[model samples]
Target: MRTEEYAMHDHRRLGRELGLFDTDPLMGAGLPYWLPDGAVVRHVLEEYVRDAERAAGYRHVYSPVLGKRELYEISGHWAHYSEDMFPPMRLGGEEVVLRPSLCPHHALIYRSRSRSYRELPLRMAELGCMYRSEPSGVLGGLTRVRAIQLNDAHVFCTLEQAVGEARAALALIRRAYVDLGIRAARFRLSLPGEGGKYVADPELWSRATALLREALDGIAYEEAAGEAAFYGPKIDVQIADPAGRESTLSTVQIDFHQPERFGLGYIGADGARHRPVMVHRSVVGSVERAVAHLVEQHGGAFPVWLAPVQLLVLPVGEAQEEDAHDVVRRALALGLRAEVADPGQGTLGARVRAARLVPYVAVLGEREAGAGLAAVRLRDGRRPGAVPVEELLGRIGGVARARGAELWEAS
Candidate 1:
């Protein structure tokens, strides 16, 4: 409540102090327990991911959070990225590993069926909760938790369709960010390095990387880089926080070697079996990391749709309580997450304090009952004095529709 006090995201101490989430020392670090409000934000992220996947023709499937250990071995993941995984467990005398990525599981899905050329580009998506046993020091808040909910998926397509899939993923990420009014992200066409883990032959990496690069031209990135995944080169959507830290939040990696590693193939139109290229892409990165980025980026002042509660109807007194209920009912009917603050909680100052602390567009005062007008205040502790209740609702609804960064940008 002090003017100089930084928000929870601005001050890590504040996040833990506020009870949004928790990190435990006894849990061996990088682990978090989601409070009820934190869970709401996580659910919001999944909804965004699902909407994008559906529009892009991705079929959703729920896969087990843990996969048999041999599955990673067969996919060459154990050989390269094993250190990131938790210790394997004994399941029916076989080792089972908590999934660190979704590609291997998705590969098994593709392997479940006899392939047809008509289904060359099979897009499979899952918001798979996975575990990566990062050492204690690597976990910081939600940004680098040991447990991760990954918005992960894969596109199994004939080599010719790989570029199209990559471009589609790029378009979806850009569109989602633009619609959210986030113009800070920069897409990088990550290229392979000299002696990189790319499919051994230099020519294949160059060709595939070049093809993906061509798709990124004119997309307006802050810069490009030679940093790439081991299997292939692709795009990494690098985002920066206000604190000047940069991290890749979404990635589209072209994996030419993985299909061959697993002997994956489909009947081509030419009537012969051919290896399909696998594009591993994630739109929101680890939901934990995405949440951390968003918290810091907006200083924990989330936008309307992303906000846990879009608005809090604040009645000035007992007389206006029914009208406050009316406003809350209307907001809820319109599908904007709305709630009526407990009138008995405390004085008006305490009500405003609670609303501001929880980040809600607070509607206050008696004008709301007189002419169905509203005394509007933002979650950021901004009061718009008084305005017509209908007009206030329209304004807040527009902001929520666009997922605006703040409720009252004009004021």
Candidate 2:
């Protein structure tokens, strides 16, 4: 697709047309409500990340969306990152704020119990919700929203193990991008610039930056000062919009400041306490932004595995309705998101057009339905002619299960 066409594939317009998500004046600007279809996509993506994290030895955890004001104060967010954070709310004499980051809670979780050398590399992950106090002018669609569901994770590891952990996190980010078909615009090493809202610890900053550099060893990256988080330096996986505007989709950072501030440590083999380095990583930074990019990346034609509705069954006429419904049921049984386009809803041609973005469309007519076959049409304009119902289901299911980029080749 042309660059301009990609720009035109704005998620805001496609979202409404495809009935993925919506926003309202009464419901507030940045808080978008995902329609049923959008919810399916988001759920699948989140589950994928969770499964990946589990396989990578990351223990999933849930933390409250709101945190005590003193928590951020201790983490230095109140000092260095308060502008982006929502204001604290007075609650029965104590104050709490919607968390802007998940690291503080994870830090507390790590410190909840005494740790030994064996658990040095404890990876904690969460699909946590956090709020940003974005201005009214910046509140756009899914890309720039007030409330974010971040695919966040942090590893508390000994200083010696920090680089390896960060490298592993980078590999996970790259794998996710390949599976999701997202192209990285560039890789960036975001560092502390001349002067900004950053932790003023020279020794810790230098150590964190060097570790990130070592982790990014052979990878090509650009250095951008003042782009580092308040606490550390990070390697950011940048993606571009249709207009060539770049944004971070994934990141791996090494932080030494938070552990010191939170007084986190582990018992060493020599029977002494030592601070563990914090590796902050995200496979897909924000679920909302990832989906927005996916929406534009494939236009509305998502790959079968990620597509909200993988299969659309269309009956030639009312006489074939039962057969169409049966096909949908069978597809559903194969773990496909299948639905029949009701004959009463529109003409067969119109129905097919309406489901143009769907990865697979099965047309059931009297001949095919009677013979237990389906005339399958792929979204990429390929027709494999009429095939037996069982074979069609198996082929599509296999491809979807494999998360392949294309359907089975036509025979």
Candidate 3:
């Protein structure tokens, strides 16, 4: 397809064409339902991030989606960001609101027990679901949804450890983007300026901003004055699409006010209690937005590991049905996502064309079945010709395991 034609494979169109997701007006705008294929992709991505977090010494936690209205008030979000949050719902005697961020909840968890300096750098991670009252004019597919599953985490540490924690967070974001073949278009140091949206304490803001600068020193980034969050200064990693539209995919913020506001503290080596500095970070900002980016980045042809259907077994005719089923069984045993195309559904060419969206397709016929082999065809038009079943499995399995971006090394 021409580049212009291929650009039409935007997430909205591809989501419908591939049966990935859907939306309904009756249910509500900005809410999406993930179909089976899309759910598989989501599951894969979520597991990948979970494993990465585990290896990084992050302790995962599950927090409620709703909290008392006073919780946000303590976090200072009620005063600064009330316009973006869903209205408080009165349940019985208490007013509850859908949580707009996980920072406050994590802070509450840290404050639940007395902590010491030895446990200073506590990393809390969650796949937290949040709701925001986004304006109808700005809601666009998965990119700007009302509900989001944020790959959020918070690090509570002493002021001395804050810079290292920020660096660690940035490293995680770099590794994730590299593995997923995403290009970091630019780095932005968003700082507070004359805007009244920022926290009122100038001294706290100055300290937080200085720490962020020290952590980001030697890193190539441009400063954007007046773009900081209400409670902190942040480093935003912006990713550009094929059309050069940029979106913030990863962020790390240094927060000083929220910790003090929430009265979160740990006993220092001097035997004095001091508030712990909080570092807020997200490697893949929002899982839904990540999916949208990947869908457009790969043009619906995901990497082997991320593809909903990694392989398709197409029998030339009904005579090779058993062979096709056998191939699928073997593929499944090897942990490959494979499906057998029904020969009775349509012509072999038509079926192959339809299944071309999948990464690999194995064609089985009387010649190949009798020879105990199958002709492997790659979607990228690389025909490796007839190969033994075991070799085919090994090759594709290796690619899936390695999460290779290309079908053939030469290609």
RMSD of each: 3.6, 1.2, 1.9
* Candidate 2: residue 325 Cα off by (Å): 1.2
Best by lDDT: 2
Taking the tens digit of each residue's C-alpha lDDT, what string does model 3 give over 1-411?
556865686898898899889999986989998999999999999988998999999999999999999999999889999999999999999999999999999999999999999997999999989999999999987899999999999999998999999999999999998788888999999988885677899898789889999999889999998878999889999997667788898999999898888898899999999989999999999999999999988889898899999989989999999988998899899998999999988898898889877988999989999898989889987888888988888888888878777685642
TM-score of each: 0.87, 0.98, 0.96
- How high is the CA lDDT of each candidate model? 0.76, 0.92, 0.90
For lDDT, candidate 1 versus 2, the one ahead is 2
Q: After superposition, how far is residue 186 of candidate 2 from its true place, in Å?
A: 0.9
For model 2, the superposed segments whose C-alpha errors exceed 4 Å read: 1-4
lDDT of 3 at 331: 88
Q: What is the lDDT for 55 in model 2?
A: 98
* TM-score of model 3 vs. true structure: 0.96
The window of 10 residues in a row where model 3 has the poorest summed lDDT is 402-411
Q: State the lDDT of candidate 1 residue by residue for 310-363, as single tens digits.
A: 778888778878888888888777877778887788988887776665445455
Worst 10 residues of 1 by lDDT: 2-11
> How does candidate 1 fare on TM-score?
0.87
Backbone collision tally, model 1? 0
lDDT of 2: 0.92
